[model samples]
Target: MDTNTLMRTLDGTLTCTTLYGHKYRSAITGQDRMPMALEGLTRGKSLWIDSLVHFTCPLTPQQETQHLSRTPVPGSVCLHTPEETVTLHERGADVSFSEHDVPEDSFLSYRPRLLMAVTNITITANEWQHTEEWQLDLEEI
Candidate 1:
């Protein structure tokens, strides 16, 4: 589906298990510590979610140029209503990683390892939002 429609479908929050390690360590990626569990979120166009969830975040004007870097495992983010689970990386899927830094005083960076990175996530319009963004609680298939 188109970017606009995908954003509208995933207009709420999402949680991911693949993101836990990202919260405790550095975003620049030198410190490879143990993986931890992180529940990330995304919204209309104001907030930036975690690395694992950013591929489904809403698009901004400038991110149109950012590229979809290769994902080795490219974990999944699940949405509901159709009982759908969105795979963050598919061949030729349009995911952008252009970032907008969160100000030091902004609440977005109030946590331990919070970083405001804007990524545009586009998915099919047929899906619907889930009430709770708790993908972390799901067991491995």
Candidate 2:
């Protein structure tokens, strides 16, 4: 699992183990190719590899949502990646809603039935956030 799917422990330390795809899949696509093993601090040094039985690993996606540091409310939308772009779609009235009737991002554009009378909207960028990974290596720190 990547950092996006990883959860940190109480002391701001991350615990993870390499998965060979037996009990739980390693990567998101289920292809186990982790370059490093579990990390731990013992005595005073940082340890990389640990016994398989002693390693801390990420849980499956389903299991993760349950115990997430920010647990998702039932029926809420969950974006797995920061780069993931989501478009607005109005689910039917039959859509199961939890504490909210509509998703936060979709609320402004949401229509009760299906369609709306909105004509136009202007898009503006207020801030320039971090760039993608491929652009990083090309720039000098």
Candidate 3:
């Protein structure tokens, strides 16, 4: 399948390009903070939550070029799609923090109001397989 056709098959394809930020908390690492006590040490060992967003779609050559030109930059704004949220929910995902109050059900309209940065963008083309796909990876800023 070509990239454009593959995109048409997806429920939602992200088109918006606006970057936003959200507050995230992580323990002060040993390099940054000295443990006050055994409890503090134990608590510090707890894993930190670094939200990640990944999605794949087919893009036109122009779109692919645009993405290649825009991504992996510190200033680039992120884009998202409702299908991404729905998929995450289906997979039992949770938002540890949210800019808006998340209801127990039906946040299909909710677009995460969190700041994210593009970490990587990958384009794969296989002529024999007749497949071209764009993979976007984002990490919490």
lDDT of each: 0.27, 0.26, 0.31
Point to the candidate with the largest TM-score. Answer: 3
lDDT of 1 by residue, 1-141 (tens): 322222322657553334333322212221123232233523222332233423323334333222333232233321111233333332232333223332222111011113333233322222243222222211111
Ranked by TM-score from best down, the candidates are 3, 1, 2
Q: Which numbered prediction scores highest in lDDT against the true structure?
A: 3
Candidate 3 lDDT over 1-141, as tens digits, reads: 322233322567654332343333222222112222333322113322332332233322222111221122222222233333422221112221233233333222122223344444445566666655554444444
> Which residue pairs in candidate 1 collide?
20-38
Model 3 spans > 4 angstroms off: 1-109
RMSD of 2: 22.1
**Poorly placed runs, candidate 1 (over 4 Å):** 1-50, 53-73, 77-82, 86-89, 95-141
TM-score to true structure, per model: 0.17, 0.13, 0.23
Off by over 4 Å in 2: 1-111, 130-141
Better of 2 and 3 by lDDT: 3
Q: After superposition, how far is residue 34 of candidate 1 from its true place, in Å?
A: 13
Ten residues in sequence with the least summed lDDT for candidate 3: 61-70
lDDT of 2: 0.26
What value does the lDDT take at residue 1 in candidate 3? Answer: 33
Give the total clashing residue pairs for model 3: 3
